[model samples]
Target: MAKNNGDGKLHVAMLPWLAFGHLIPYLELAKLMATKGHKISFISTPKNIHRLPPIPKTLTPFINFIKIDLPKVKDLPENAESTKDLPFNKVKYLKIANDGLQKPIQDFLKTSSPNWIIYDFATYWLGSLASELGIRTAFFSVFPAVMLGFLGPPNVLIHGDPDNNDNDNTIIIKRPKWVSFETQVRPSLYQLTRWGHYNSDGENMSDVYRLGATVDGCDAVFVRSSFEFEPDWLNLVKRLYKKPVIPVGFLPSTSDTKDDDININNNDSSWLVTKQWLDKQEKGSVVYIAFGSEAKPSQYELTQLALGIELCGLPFYWVLIDQRGASDEEVIKLPIGFEERMCGRGVVCREWAPQFKILSHDSVGGLLIHSGMSSVIQGFQLGKPLVLLPFSAEQDLNATYLVEKKLACMVPRDVDGSFEPESLADSLSLVIVKEEGNMYRDKAKEMMSLFGNRDIQDQCLDELLHFLSTSIK
Candidate 1:
């Protein structure tokens, strides 16, 4: 049998996917558990674990990071960080991850075992195996509660038909009997851009199969959201999963600032400097534009964004990631003299930036984003107004939910699937100078307050510990 820490403090293990979006939140949860006197073992591949900044020696007393070697796979991309970066599909990634988990985790359990494991979506394959070994498992879904509500019920995932074939239009909304079209649609706007995957037929089949396989034989499924946000959906999910379905809110109760000097190799430090710059600017004067790591716009959209920022005439910071159209041999080729004209007025980081710190900066009045949930949650948490530009995947749904719900404004993606300079500028103007902008900013603040104030973390921690204690006993 797996052994506990022996202090009545739950011994918790964490296993997240390779993606930054997945890794950051799970790490935050691990930090929270460690603060609650729980012993933690954060498991990841050596490449991934080494990417983390070192926690100060002071916080080292509570947590341990366990690194295991990734199995040898041929023709894998060099410097592959997460499953997202792999050349294969999500299904393929899960299969390999499941194979990888069996041996290392089994060996870990045979040695120093954890009472409970707070695992990510990709780790679902290990559920039955973990249970067989006498360790309890809980699933931590990084997506919103509503997505969980939709995906949680095995029937909806298995039996339901998508609303449309267009990845942009496949919005199959299941509202609470109490919510009206307006309120439900309102809440759905911010979610639309993020849930873009539901719009595509390809995603529907793959996601359904993957989620069903993952949720099977798991102990509990916890969503990172709140009851107030979607009480009816949460109830629906509970009925469907027939397991403990809980919403743990956005932020945890406590976070230990470990890894003070941990540097993400390709991440840029200019963002921190921008934070200082924003601190000096007038409140709400600057706009922050960032498409998450996956978005790779064609050369046309790149020019359009540049033109839009130029037309908006706002002091802005645009941190670009994974802009793949340009090769290593060719530098970023801007419109003629675009840099000279916009010099000092704009900043673009081809590398990753410190997003949370930038959003929290006082001068950052608004954000232009691809509606990734992590970015959306953080943006909302910081009370910054948003202009959503959803690409593919869940981002389209998230953006839709935020905008349709009046939490943000949508800068509709281009025909080729990008944001144009004109629409981009219009959206920016509406949010910053238009009457609608004022409303969005105010509503964003309200949402931020709700997310920040809800003691979701404490509730989650308490429930997780309870489950661990019961299982170990």
Candidate 2:
């Protein structure tokens, strides 16, 4: 329970999805609100809450961690509370378990009497539940604004047109009449089929419907984007959703300071070792490669990526999380003599590495990654040019935006969503080794000023606070 300041300060309950990608941004927003003298109840399952980055000691007074047990489902594995714990095929089971949280969450809202509930797409039921309890609800989207615009109106997304026959072969997205800008964010047939399968729970509502209902039912929509980056797309979302669409600027971690300011001794030995390796590399010569937590690359794809990295012949640091069922000895089977051949040029870390620390390193000039929004923001914040190898639909859309904006280069992929080693090597070279790469480097640097602007982010926070205050009253 939050202690009210007696100054009409709002108490906000933050309810994000099971995925860390979604939970982290919600937690960042909660921290921002807490900094503004608001009370925050950061709600999540026990395991998910346990995995969150440490909250600053200063914020402990204003923020409370409320854990609710995740309901068990028959198909979901034990202790699998988030997307990172499961393969892509098992993600739907996580969502099914998430739906079970509604009753416990509703019970909390009834007793807590918070002024507002900030929720994610999967928790659409929270909107109506909050409303029933006389609480305001806001949908905080961790995705880019362009994705919502591309998805079109709630009605359209819920009931897509039967006449439309768009498939994977289409290079350009079929834009709605309201969307004035040209979009190259095309979803492949394979990705769409996977999406369909994920949503094919018998008689249960699809993710699109749930998301649409959440947006339609909420008081306002908050996106983890900046107005400067996607003005047209953001404007289109406002028109399509017919709600107050607020851009909260990329919700970067406030603790992200320069390496010099950080106490290296406080970091673990692995981080120190990685940093030492990075320190040995020349400035702007190393490529930092990570595909985020959720993307599980097939062994074939992993091998292709390894070969591509070798082909590029550049100093690289690759973070590869071990396969779920792989043995310790067979965790990462690289090409024979590959490590020996590339000694001093590449390092493959088979465990979690501090991504922000690596990204902010002076030696890292380029990023090879799946275009998750958090990764995208982190990459742009440090002005690192990108080599995008998107592994999912949202990532593909993000990659398209980066390519269209001239901030990154996307590796050419087959219609089946597979990429050849040669293509990956070429894209990496184009972004890192080629003379023309400077344009991307310059663009990334230019955008850093806007994307990483703390002042603008504070202003956005002010706007959000003002909205919550005025609307709640």
Candidate 3:
């Protein structure tokens, strides 16, 4: 059994990658630890920190937001601190800037000297830093454990494919020789190539290299997954990494606070209009569409998507972000007369929408979204079936997993990984209107037995806390 300190309090420092997908889970863990009487220092750049969800007032005292200055890079745009602020190619610059934080973070560690430092995969340097300060380090992965298992050990990932000559054909993904069971999570050759390119040669170290080092160096590893959902993969991760691989349960948003209360109190007109529109829709009739924060679709893709939604001929609420900065023309141009054709049945929101509230609404029966892990958890939590359109970075893997598990249906894409309007419409209809989708609906609801079990999740957290407490001594 693990032993807690005399006062049963531990000081922990959290460091997550700059993306919201990475940052949010780290914050959730910090909040969970805070509720257990731990003091946490959450570190990030200023702009990224400013964008985090509002921390509950009661827990504010125990959690400290520490800001580090982002180093200036020539190609990286000014004030672009997070992945959300940059286009796909420019993301490497953000990583370079993040690597520059080593000295500042090292300095902070020397002074604060926390018992344990919980970090994300990108910060491979953190393990050495924690060692120098006589503190323990734990790696908290926001991605699913199954995806990690498919990638296999770090040596295989970094050194296995050294020739780079495997680009001529589609590589079939299958169960590694080390693993016993077959996995459904497979990436196409194009997806793998893009991934390889992103993490390949860079001014600083590559992400793949960093991930290998972090896994080898950390004291323990924690993944945002559950045994009920992925027992085999969880077991394989421990065997592959040769470390304590802990599952921390899917971190769902605990805030049930209604946005209507705040909207009504503040007299916000736009939200009132949107909420009233949602109220009028028939139960389980509307499809909620959002492609996630980081995916920037081209104008042609956006136009095709609009047409596809129109062709589906269902009531839909779509959230599209405006990426054209200071331009006079619209960022996403819908097919001409689209609004006039489907005025009452469709609503488009260019600004931020309350995603949780919309997902929880009675009118929402299904989701049309990118295969983000966070979105997957939310949809599963609400028992909403998915029409998946994956864009980049582990999303294809997520889509494959959901489809194989019968929890969702994926939109068909071309050999080059591009989707057409017809295929998009067909996927939407299959999930929302066709009889074939019922199995997905049933399987998604069945997941509630595990995904909604608060007791199991609490037990997992307790085990994690115990590990943290004991690892210090």
155-246: candidate 2 lDDT, tens digit per residue: 76666644455633233245556577777665656666646666777746678888888897898999999888898889999999998999
Runs of candidate 3 exceeding 4 Å displacement: 1-5, 162-169, 172-174, 196-201, 256-270, 322-332
Instruction: Quote the lDDT for 73 in model 3.
Output: 87
Cα lDDT of model 3 by residue, 252-367, tens digit: 76664223111212333566687788899998878999887777666777887888898887899988765722321335577789888878998987766777788888888799
What C-alpha lDDT, on a 0 to 100 scale, does residue 413 get in candidate 1?
A: 58
In angstroms, how far off is 466's CA in candidate 3?
0.6
Clashes per model (N, Cα, C within 3 A):
43, 0, 0
Worst 10 residues of 3 by lDDT: 257-266
Q: What is the alpha-carbon lDDT for the whole of candidate 1?
A: 0.66
Every candidate's lDDT = 0.66, 0.80, 0.79
Provide the lowest-lDDT 10-residue window in model 2: 257-266
TM-score of 2: 0.92
- Poorly placed runs, candidate 2 (over 4 Å): 1-5, 165-172, 201-204, 256-267, 324-333
Using all chains and alpha carbons, the TM-scores for the candidates as numbered come to 0.82, 0.92, 0.92
**Candidate 2 steric clashes:** 0
Model 1 spans with C-alpha error above 4 angstroms:
3-5, 83-99, 155-207, 252-262, 265-272, 298-300, 323-336, 414-419, 454-456, 471-473
* Ranking of models by lDDT: 2, 3, 1
